[model samples]
Target: MTERETTYEAPQGEGRDRQPAGQASPAERSVGDSVFHRHERAVDEVPDQPAVIAPGEKYQLSSAGRRWRIGEIFKLLRKYEVWNDITPVRLRCLLEELGPIFVKMGQILANRSEILPQRFCDELRKLRTDVDPVPYTIVRDCLHAEYRRPLSEVFSWIDEEPLGSASLAQVHRARLVTGEDVAVKVQRPGAQQVMAQDIDIMRSIVRLASHFVQTDQFVDLHDVVEELWESFREETNFIMEARNLDDFYEFHLGTKGISCPRPYMKLCTEHVVVMDYVDGVSISDPDALIDAGYSLKQLGSRIVEDYSTQVLDDGFFHADPHAGNIIVKDGVVYFIDLGMVGRMSNHDRLIVKDIIYSVAEGDVPKLKDSLLRFAVSRGDSGALDHAAFLSDLDYIVADFAGLDLKDLDIGEFLTSLVNLARKNDVELPSVVTMFARGMVTLEGLLSEYMPHVNMIQIIRSHIANEKSTYKRLEDGARELSVESLRAARGTLEAAEHIGLATRMLTRGQLKVNTQIMGSEEVLRHVGGIVDRMSMSIVIAGLFIGSSVVYYAKIEPVIFGIPVIGFLGYASALILALGLGREIWRNGHARK
Candidate 1:
């Protein structure tokens, strides 16, 4: 059998009682006790079931349950008087009381200072995900169920006290049987089930609220829910986290001054992850680093430099780089918690490069183009007001013109640019937003370490150093060649069209079609004028005929007037009065 198959399967001829091949042992059975597993089993039992279900269906909550949860949420909102006045502290408190999903949402929003006020972002940043630790016995039982072999075969020792506990999982330091120290991250039992239910509830609330509220004016409720769901999915799947660690480890191979934990793939599963244990000072505690004889400025500079490399060169970066996720050991910075990361394609990276370069050079048009290229348009492109967008961009660029790198705030600048894009009906990708938030978090860390260190300057320097002059020249030449070919093709197409038109003209078969803009409205006005003129002519005829008839009176008369003439006169007066009122109303409307 293959190595992967062996890793998950029970060993053959073991001394312990063995089930038939492909049958799960008691330990394996116990591992499937979570609701997520039960749901999977239930689905598997069904015949001809599709591979996937809608999010609402997959994360099902009964009608009554959903209503009750929504009621609780509304009550909390009312209690805080969120509609009338929502302070930063009150918002934070509401999120905390709402539960983990809401707290996660607040944490994400905390990074979006461009959308929220800085004070609100600051208050949200203060949100702590530390929850009460799961009992040690439960942790042990979970680990035992995950391992096919006995616990003693894998870990020599595991600390009863958790190293740290968070909303999703808790970490504990353990020593492997191979005498290497490792950190084991165990998922809380039924954590995924609870998170899934909460997400479903959130979706329901957003959907219900959307009917009576125009929330899209401020934020995309559906997008926020999806983003939260995506984050939750990644953060809960320890297997994906293990893979991320492996990839990041490979990325940092032979690199210096920066590292990530090396995951033990054999020991990792959906519910558990075992990786190299980092025993280092958390970057959050600057005092300890200073006591450890580390230069804070150098550390901060290194972080910014390494992060730039991760983003621009590697394209994969740690999405959440809060101080807690970073540690310093012997001057080496270790980025941990690979649950969340961001990625940019080569095309996106180039556009980002152009955006940064254009901003630095104060090229407003170029900046606008790069931003538009990076943004995803929600409406008709033709409907976009490019001139107005450019004007706004010009204002933003002017604010940053001639500013020294050290004085520039990268996070604030990115936020402004994103906000401008949003205001102009353009949306940047979620990864870009994620990167912006990561930068803001990084900047916050730098403030504590060394306030003067400029992240943008570091990024600029890194970009310059990343490519040689010859390489850049080659890239420029390639781009020029591509553009030249496009231009030549366009010229040829124009010539062909002209030749056809000339031949048609020589043959006396040429025709031209013209259309005036706003012709529909013009035609409607013309029709109205004609109707009014026709009515006036009829009115004049009626008055003239009635006068003639009255003067010629040769038939029965009523009070010295012919009956037909009298009726005509009455009709003409009524018509004239009606026409006059319409004319007067139209004249007043114009005014």
Candidate 2:
């Protein structure tokens, strides 16, 4: 019990590597000391600790519900003759017992069908976020406070009954005084508090779960939950949603094909967002849409073309494109709920294009290299799995080869690739997952309508266009070489100046009259002088090399013919001689 209690202390925030500028408090100092001692103790005698929970909470079934014990989670399968198949059914049952947050988490997990088994995602895909609507009084009060107006002045007709209620917010059909039809997305009062509490619990559970479940280590589950929390928090703020809607409107301005619901600025508030209601059949109901005189194939193509343009061309996209969030009215696709959108930096956008082009051309090594470089630079360490990652890519390319262009499950493949990367400990860049989820949902919606549309061929054409753009980018990079050279020269000069200044400043030595100091102290001081001399030599060589590389752009062998190359070699030798002299003088004086 004592040992368990001791192990339960929270992990220190990764020591000096992660510490911010602020001075450490006494408590923090103690924690750092303890961490160092504990690490040393482990080296002497490794203790058996509970399993690791990678990125999320450390959930014990007991915390949520005593009906199931941690032991029972595994034991029930054995006792109930269900041990042979722990498939999606067992998972769904567990999530149901765990409650709403877990259900929503499961649904998010479901979207990553590639990383998770199809059976599991299929089962969790059924998990919905519909909760009982809060009382109309609570909703009205929230609306009043958020908008700072009486409910009467805001809408000509506001329905008390919610169109849909979820964990975060509820949607109600309403009309503005201007007579524009709209959906009033109202936040439930205190949802932020509820979500924060739930997330705290989830985080705790994820921390502990990682210890017991090896899979938890594959994904940064804690980071995933934290990101989800931030996403949902933004969803609660109607102002951000309004901004997202506006961003989308501007994003699709030149194009006639893509459209997002127009937010009524006057009617929108922190708690309530009023947008032109999309009065169309849901994307999920393809047959109904087809019957409504819409060409399913055309609709599918439009979805692909529009979304591809948003992600690839504009670099901003709706992260969630579930059928519920998209509607088709008169063949025009209307996007609703712009709470979660993905934004890619120009660099990442280029990397994504590279990935797309590589995937289209079936360039394995290029794809692998691009993915690894991107992952290493853009993602955290725990988020990448190098070997399994490559294997998954291989399988994805090989598995989906012979399908008709339109019938190809591009979304599934991408999602699976992301999930594979995630599961193998590669933390996917947020934009990549956003693209993956958006593409998957778009593809899924499209496939329902256009059974024969060749998505692969379409994407291939898009990739060709992207390649042209990439060439332009390459030319721009070449243009930047001049700027890069100037920057490199400035940096080298600054380093040289700093080195000279430090040397001048430290030329005078402090003589401590400590009679008790022995031969070991002398040796330590001599060793420190040697180390500094060695570092000076390395820095001097680097400075000379930088000058040669930046200005001359020439590789220098000792036997190089040119003046600058020979100068670089001579400069390096002089620095080495100076360092050797310093070492000799310092070492002799110490002796």
Candidate 3:
């Protein structure tokens, strides 16, 4: 089998010149010149001196100072006509210049074509965190600090050349003194601190931007930032990743055709991880895999089946299963990079199964119920229009009904479902979004290997085969029992409340307060109508009284009319004209 290629390749410069240790590579220099060089002077103006302040104070000061400096530099650039219109390339370059946190943000946005344009998403997909490898001295220092031992005590031979280098960490090939080949992943020095600081800055920026930007139309920016921090925290913790690897290894112990790296727990720490060195051909290289006597179709099917089991049955899954993260050795598929994983609760897993089953059966009502159960209401659940939500689901179901199993795109379907939920004022859990992105990525990787593989069909079949009729009936009975008990409890509570209310009413102690939305305006409008009606009644009474006075001759006559009748007639005329003028004014105001 062909050995797996290096995880990242440094961009080649003109003539492919090499750089010495502790210096920037040609690629890094070019990037800095384009983005940072222009604003170097402005950035230098900010004092970098340490101060005696509280932890929170220090963080606030640092984040605020950085934000202000960035804003100033951007303003200066714009004023000087040094910046151009932001295109896809410029945006990616800017994110790179902004640092790893922003680069991760851009990468996340790359998969979100529903929110961004296709071209932008395509361009962002090219975003890579590959930088010059950390110097060997720094790498040695990190290992010594983590292990607290001499190099000879652990590894007999360690390669200075990095297998891969990313923003968060770098991996190198090594052999243990015990004669075992292993891979050493060292977390970059100060990576955690920089990430924490950048995350704070990101939160501050998002909070400030929320005032002028409406992100409810898409995903919440605040949630996005928080999720980014959570992911960063998980990915940077090497111990956690080692634990994940152990769990995954155990889960697949007896399973065939799937494997993952086994970490050496004794050697793993927050700053470093050591695991088995996987020597295999990357699944991305189809020709090499074929040459190694592996059937592409079989590999794709096996991967899909295993992934389905990971999600639906195990409730734990490899969140990022891109081409680079997968490899093949002797017909066995290996999943590496256990740093980032997703987990779902049992309840969520069952709901997801129901969703898939409903879609397969073309049952719209069941699909709606499953989605609503899976979704979270941002506000009052009672406020949602069930009718409209059901209507939208019907349209989505109809659109999918016509597509054949092979023609169905599971990623697109899930995205549409998520978008519909968002439009109806409901939000799915973050895990669901992550799963959707993972599925899309996995599909893209398998598009060439297995064009006829239907993920939805496979999942549906898995669900069916996993549950027997007896099991299904047992589950139904359990659910029915729970719902029946809840209903009984609710009914009893209602009766007791009604009896209490009746007693209060008999004793004249019952009080009811009703609050209507927009009540102030409603009440004001009602009061105005009442005033107008009262004024009309008074004017009519005056007219009738005046006519009666004139007929009865109650006062001294003036020009064949009683004096009181004449005064009443004048008053009524003035009042009527005033009411007319007020009506006209109100009408014009409304218009």
User: How does each model score on TM-score?
Assistant: 0.76, 0.61, 0.71
Candidate 1 accuracy as TM-score: 0.76
Q: What's the residue-level lDDT of 352 in candidate 3?
A: 89
Residue-level lDDT of model 1, residues 473-554, one tens digit each, is 9999999999999999999999999999999999999999986644677898899899889989988999999899999994
RMSD of each: 8.9, 23.2, 9.5
Per-residue lDDT of candidate 2, residues 73-165 (tens digit): 345335545546666777776665443456667867777554566778777866666666665545554564454434556566666667887
Ranking by lDDT: 1, 3, 2
- Weakest lDDT window of 10 consecutive positions for candidate 2: 3-12
Q: Is candidate 2 or candidate 3 better by TM-score?
A: 3
**Pairs that collide, model 3:** none
**Per-residue lDDT of candidate 3, residues 1-591 (tens digit):** 211122112233311123335543332333323323322333345334312335563223354545554674475446544356667876777666556777888877776665667788778766778776766656765665555445667877777778888877889888888888899998776565556666877787788887788667323567668888989888888999999999889999998989998899999987789999988999878899889888888888899999998998888899888888899987789999888888999999989888877777789989988888887764445476677788899898888867888888888788788878877877788889888878877887887556766777787788878889999899999999999999999999999999999999999999999866446788999999999999999999999999999999986998889999999999999999999999999999999
Query: Which lDDT values do the candidates have, in the order given?
Result: 0.79, 0.66, 0.77
**Could you tell which candidate, 1 or 2, scores higher by lDDT?**
1
